[model samples]
Target: MQTVDKALKLLEFFRTDQPEIGLSDLARLAGYDKAATRRFLVALMGHAFIEQNPASRKYRLGAAFLHFAQVREATLPLATVVTPLLDALSAETGETAHASHYSAGALIAIGIRESSRANRVHLDPSEILPLHATASGLAFLAFGPAAPLEAAVDQGLRAYTAHTITDAAALRGAVAEVRRAGYAISNQGFEDEVVGIAMPFFDSSGTATGAIAVATPASRMSDELRVLILANLHKAALAATAGIGGIPAEAFVRAHGERRAA
Candidate 1:
């Protein structure tokens, strides 16, 4: 188990911008003995999970990684499932709409649709939403499993901006509010200029799979605009949830019902 953990740690060293690492860098990053890192790399190489570059003596994630990712993607196909929702949401709200997937306790942007407007919020596929600082992360925390939320709090919350939630207790309180409201809102939490709203969608088993969000410039945020965005966002969330054969969080459904009744 320890060996497996170390080998997995090496994989984390590769990222979108830095896809390759040398043996010395890997050893330093792993914080393990150089020889141990070498052994792990050798084992990963044997399994084709990591490949070496003959020119630079650097290593990169190999074909097996892509194969496994393709297998998982083929089964779930999150991008294919969510892109249309993003497009519709962007059109309806006239704002930048994006969708993220929850994986290994992180919310990763899977798809995004930029509004036709020249000045719109921009999101890249590689962006990871901070659990304490983004609407998508807050929605997932509110509607998804409890373990990941607790683990994230345990790891500590780093403030990204003045509006970011830094206290663990405050973050819990914020998430509780999201549960009560049926959706999550982040006002300049992750970025000073952006205000975002998000709703979580569940998988076939009724587990929260991910979240979809619309982000607008703070200057454009008003009571009327917020209402408009949420209304369209709710419509998109429901359609996306149903299209994927997934479920909406019960609190969301119940709150929606109460709103209708009122």
Candidate 2:
């Protein structure tokens, strides 16, 4: 068990950016002797979870994780429910819509629906956004624990654009607004040229399991446009929340009725 834990620690050194690490660095990271680290890495290499660079001999994650990820994605109940909703929302609103989740303290865009309008907004799949820099992220942060939120704020809300929010007090006010309204919105906050809105979908524990959001070009997100989008957003948000399957048992019972007729 101890050896397994150490081996896993070595793998952790390779992340989204630094997807490769040398033997010496891996040894230090795992606090294991070089010889043992090499042996463990070789075993993992045999399993195809990590592969060695042909030229440098450094190690990076192999295709096994991707294979597992695909299988995992295929099994998620949300996939079936979200895709149809995203497509319908996009078709109706003529704007890009997406469903995202917060995992490992970051917002991951999991599903997308392209805008039907000639002028529209879009985000690449698998895009990761900082909690302080995006509507989906902020919606989660505002609804999530206080510690993670403050840590993210302290990590520096680097101004992404001239209009991006950087003042701590101002950002706090925005978060408060999200908490009150049960949603978050961005008008040129993350990207100066884009406007977006997001709200959380809570599981039965009242914990936010995921979020759904839509975006439009800055010009299309004007006062009148926002009104229309909000109406559509409200409908979609409620529907999405209702379909999310991970309800707490108590909440599930309440919704379905405590007693069932025979």
- Best of the candidates, TM-score: 1
Superposed model 2: Cα runs more than 4 Å off: 1-47, 50-61, 74-76, 246-262
Give a tens-digit lDDT track for model 2, residues 146-202. Answer: 776788778888888786778888888888777766568887777878988886666
For candidate 1, the 10 contiguous residues with the lowest summed lDDT are: 119-128
- TM-score of each model, paired residue for residue: 0.87, 0.71
lDDT of 1 at 73: 73
How much does candidate 1 score in TM-score?
A: 0.87
Instruction: Assess the local accuracy of residue 36 in candidate 1 as a C-alpha lDDT between 0 and 100.
Output: 95
Off by over 4 Å in 1: 260-262
lDDT against the true structure, each candidate: 0.87, 0.74
Query: Candidate 2 — worst ten consecutive residues by lDDT sum?
Result: 253-262
After TM-score superposition, the amount by which residue 51's alpha carbon in candidate 2 deviates from its true location, in angstroms, is 5.0
Candidate 1 lDDT score relative to the true structure: 0.87
How far residue 251's Cα lies from its native spot in candidate 1, in Å, is 1.1
